[model samples]
Target chain A: MKKESQFTPFVEKTHFWGSIFSVLAIIVLVSVPVSIMFYLNVRPEISDVLKGFWGVALIFWPTALIEICFYTPMMGAGATYLSFVSGNIANLKLPCALNAKNIVKPKKGTDEEEVVNTIAVATSAIVCTVVIAAGVLLLSPILPKITAEGSVFGPAFNQVIPALFGALLGGYLVQYWKLSILPIAAATLIVILAPTIGTGALIPICVILSIVGALLMYNNGLLTGGVKPENPLKGLVKKDK
Target chain B: MDFKESKFMYLIAFIVIAFVIGQSLFFLIRAYNHGKKIGLSAKKMKDAITASALFTIAPAVSILATVVVLASSLGTVLPWIRLTVVGNLQYEVTAAQNAMEAFAGSGKAVAFGQDITDPTVFSAVAWVMTLGVILSLVLCPLLLKKIQKKVGKVKLDSGSDNKFGDIITAATFIGLISAFVGTSLAGKASTIEENGVKQATGMGAGVMSLAVLLTSIILVVILQTLCKKFKWDKFEPFVMPISMFAGMGMAMLVYAVLPESISMLEWRPAV
Candidate 1:
């Protein structure tokens, strides 16, 4: 008999906790409206609720389902549950976890990687919750500044995601240059040509492209037996020059 | 019945937000304990926590901007609740918009940005927004274990030459990042009507985005190189956060300095 991996029990326990939190979160979230219906005595028409829901559901439901499949493996079980419930997986949690993994250089499927991912995700969630809570408590003063036309924070806020990704790509692109080029080029071309297929949809397509490219390269022995490169920009300037 | 920011809604928001924080802390403590049991270093875990917390500040503020946008029409407490938990700006706004339109029902078609005056309309919007994201909550418990199992099978290499699992994970991440880059670079700037206001979008917006992208890339590369050369390991965790803020600062500069005809980095209304 194959001995159980030491991490199996841990993973199982994580799944149990993840499921419990997710279900409880759903109940907690749903109770708001349920309570509203009773306490306020403001019952929206069942048809109206369905009518409002269907269109948004048509878009979000499919995307949410797809997001789970894509993000689950990348984020470990604990992180996956928290992120799905708390949201902001793409822009914040996943990248934060990935960055920590990259910095720590954790091996795939290792306990260390799982711990790092969960810690990164949990910390991010805590910070975001606190910050937004502060924003709400101070909304009266901050609202006008943020919402004002031509406010300094306006342009900066708009570009936050792209900016964060830009920084992230600088390191990843260098580290995985061999595997990155084709996907980046193909994704860029598709985005340019089609333009309407938003980034959310493009992720899975690009993942396939990168995976195929990496496999082809690996089979051809292009990716193996090579040491990861040092920083290519290290020689750009001398401190004493 | 001003339910949008009513005392009851605020109380509900407080509970939900508190629950979210509690959930996060629960995971944080569990992961920390697990890390220790598995012989992971305390310093490493602490660094991850610190870096993640620092990294969250700017993006969290950006989310606050979304809250402000929705608050204009939907009310503060609702937007606050939605954004803090399982709701994003684009989806929530669209869901609210759809609900409002359904409520109006050919009378005059109320849009998302306009103040939602009807209590029933507001209630419907809240329900729609909440339900839109509930699918993941339901599906994750059912499917996550299976999905993780499938992925684990690939990753659990038994002394084989094939390391495809790790490569596949890296490829997925690279592909996702590449798509983001592509989106930032693609698109044409064109005029569009928003709330009866004709505004240019796409092209100039893309340019500004590109500028911020470049700023971030250059700053991060420089920071990394400097860290490596000087052995400033202590500053390494702060690298991403610094680059993020610097990139955002570049956005403001680009907006301020560029000629109006070319700089389409205008203040976009969230709705």
Candidate 2:
């Protein structure tokens, strides 16, 4: 392989420009509907809810677009790659039956080699979704409905599904992982203390605590439970670059 | 069947049907690949199929629970707004000549139920928008594409094997059956409205069912796409967050662009 072969398409100009188109699509989408609201003299009460929903979403979509488009895809690819590595490492000491066959084993670069393959596909998917969902989310408030109701469904309830998912995750962890108590404690404490920091800060606080706690545990060489705080975001860092 | 008419009921049926049918295809593929190692048997295969089908409902139940909580919360916040305008003197709502009529008021008792803040049917319609778009945009295309590719490639093989034929046929069939179950439940949900107060008969179950049905379809789509790419060979836990946000956006788009005449069907105060 050439020395330059180590470079990835993500760092290349074409990728950057493509992502730029996605981000542009996002910005246009978020602002368009709110602008129409201004154009049409919608009622204050109704508009307030619609506008409030739009406003929060408008801010979130761009921020999330940047994360999903540029961040999560890379992270997901690398995380899965690392998972394969760790899986091998965790299985190394044992008398694995597979090794007895003396088959052609993968080189060390199997993980890194696969990184580009995974990231390219993941990033493309992320970009496609960002455009479509963003256009829908941001522009829906302005557009008319197709069905009998005259418009689309309420989305605020959609928010509940996420919280429910969190609760479900919490349930699964509490049942399966005895070590889950630590993170749960950490989460609860962070949640309670979160308000002191300010509103909309729980996620960041949880992420930081989890990351630090995991690192501390790892440095201490006591990493078996798979119950770290930064488990998800740790999956995000595409440092293979 | 008045104000609370099920808007996206048909879509729900389509989705449940798709799930049941889709299962058969997935089974055939699984049996072909892992049946030898996992111990192939018709009985075991049937058991596996049943298990997967049942397990899918766990997430569905979780979604339903979410719907209940949300519906109740919304119900609490938005109820029937009642206002009795007894005697109202002339007052111009809009400026005709800067300012038009100015008169006296006598007795006007404005009695508002919980729904005073939001007296429109935006909430109901918003859900329809959410379900409709995902069904139309996400599930339809993904299902068609996956079937075309999976089946199309098979037909090109030297000849279709027993395993190959079974996998394709079973997967599609399972998906179809699941859609039927979902749609059946939703169809049974009743709607009633009186004196400007419109609500579903079993609001919690009905709304939650829609969300669950939509989520399952989304999971199917995500699974189809991600599996082909990553080959993870399992459903994802984080699919909800992705689907929720995506579906939410779809709802918003559907609502905003809806025509005024249709949008006007939303519930309002009869003040």
Candidate 3:
């Protein structure tokens, strides 16, 4: 029998602890409001709680489920646990992991990629916590300028997501220009034509469409490797032969 | 006791923040040790840490802005803890509003900072915000392993290995970025009545956002060229933040130069 590698056991142990600590964290977090309500001798009506929850959950729960399916494969097991717990997966954790992976050039579906992702995510979580804590501590002095209506800082702050993603996306656009056009065009058309479709719904739809488009292009020999539609899924299992 | 920023709340914030920091440190050390054991270079690991830390600062500042925004309604300590933990500003704000509306009943708009004086209402907002996002935490622990296994099985059974795997990851990323880009560009052009005079408001902000995005993309292209020309591999990590800050600065200039009638940044009534 071939001896098991040291890395597999380490990953297994990390997952075990990651799950336990995540559960503990959830318990403590839930208790905060519960304890507050208990101390104040006030409980919201179940009807009110359910109504409020349904309003947000109607959009959020589906997005959360889809996000897990989409992002878990990219981020790996440890980073997924940490990223979900820390939040800001799209705007923060995902970008951080992608940047790290881009720099390291770790082969896909490997243990090394997992390590790089974990380190990047953990560092991001630490930096985010520290920065937010510092901001809270210094809130009294900086609050006025940062939050002033019509101020330059306010506009700049609002544009951070667009600005950050625009640059980050440019890199990917360059690498996969042929594969990128369809999704970009399709998403733009959808948003322009149907203003009511929120991002929560738009993302999953666009992803499915993009994957189908790429597969079709690859099959038709439009992609770099000439028409070879043996099976796109088959490519995932075979190494770089 | 009044619903003011309190010492007790700060105590809670500190405890939660400490827990998050501890958790991150634990994972960071483990990953670092694993990297070393696998014969990954010390330099590469250090570079990843440094690069991620640098990349985090700009977004972290934006998150600080979120904390400020939420603080106006949710108080200091709670927003501090919420934004630091599993809550984003958009969801938290909407959840708080929903809870307030639920408490106030139909057809009544309860302004958050002003009318959230009732402790019961405050607790309701807390519960909604907390419970609204709790599903992710529950689902992650219980289902993440299964999800990973499924993905692995897909890869194993597919046989093509890395090509299909790469396509899935790339497609997902492209889809996500495309959604954001499209949303940012899609702004309504309807007129809003102000002082019995109709004026356009949304179009200007949308244009300004596009301008900012364009500026960032140009900056990224320039940085990419320079990094390649100068062989400055060390500077690659700073490209995102540098581009972002440049775009933000351009936005400030745009905001300053635009006329009041067509201003991109609307002046809100001071809280």
Top candidate when judged by lDDT against the true structure: 1
Off by more than 4 A, model 2: A1-52, A55-182, A195-208, A223-241, B6-56, B66-271
Candidate 1, A134-182: lDDT as tens digits: 9888775766587454787777887887788888887676567788899
Quote the lDDT for A116 in model 3: 94
Per-residue lDDT of candidate 2, residues B161-186 (tens digit): 33323222222222222222222122
TM-score of each: 0.90, 0.30, 0.89
Q: Find the candidate with the highest DockQ and give its number.
A: 3
Tens digits of lDDT, candidate 3, B15-120: 8888888888899999999889988888888888887887787788877776665566667777777887887745666676667667554433355544455666
Ranking by lDDT: 1, 3, 2
Give candidate 3's error at residue B218 in angstroms: 2.3
What TM-score does candidate 2 reach?
A: 0.30
- Per-residue accuracy of model 1 over B1-271 as CA lDDT, tens digit each: 5667788988899999999999999989998998999888898888888889988988888788778767767888888888888876556666766777676654545565677776767777788888888999999899999998877764543214335556667788988888887767664333433354554432323668888888888888888888889998778888888888898899788879998545554222222
lDDT of 2 at B64: 27
Q: Candidate 1: which stretches are off by over 4 Å?
A: A1-7, A147-149, A225-241, B106-109, B157-159, B162-165, B188-205, B265-271
lDDT of 2 by residue, A73-188 (tens): 21222222211111111111000111110011112122321222222222222222232233233533332232113224443232223222332232223222332334445544
Evaluate residue A25 in candidate 1 and report its C-alpha lDDT on the 0 to 100 scale: 91
- Give chain A TM for each model in order: 0.86, 0.38, 0.87
**Candidate closest to the true structure, highest TM-score:** 1
User: Between prediction 1 and prediction 2, which has the larger DockQ?
Assistant: 1
Clashing residue pairs, candidate 1? B189-B203
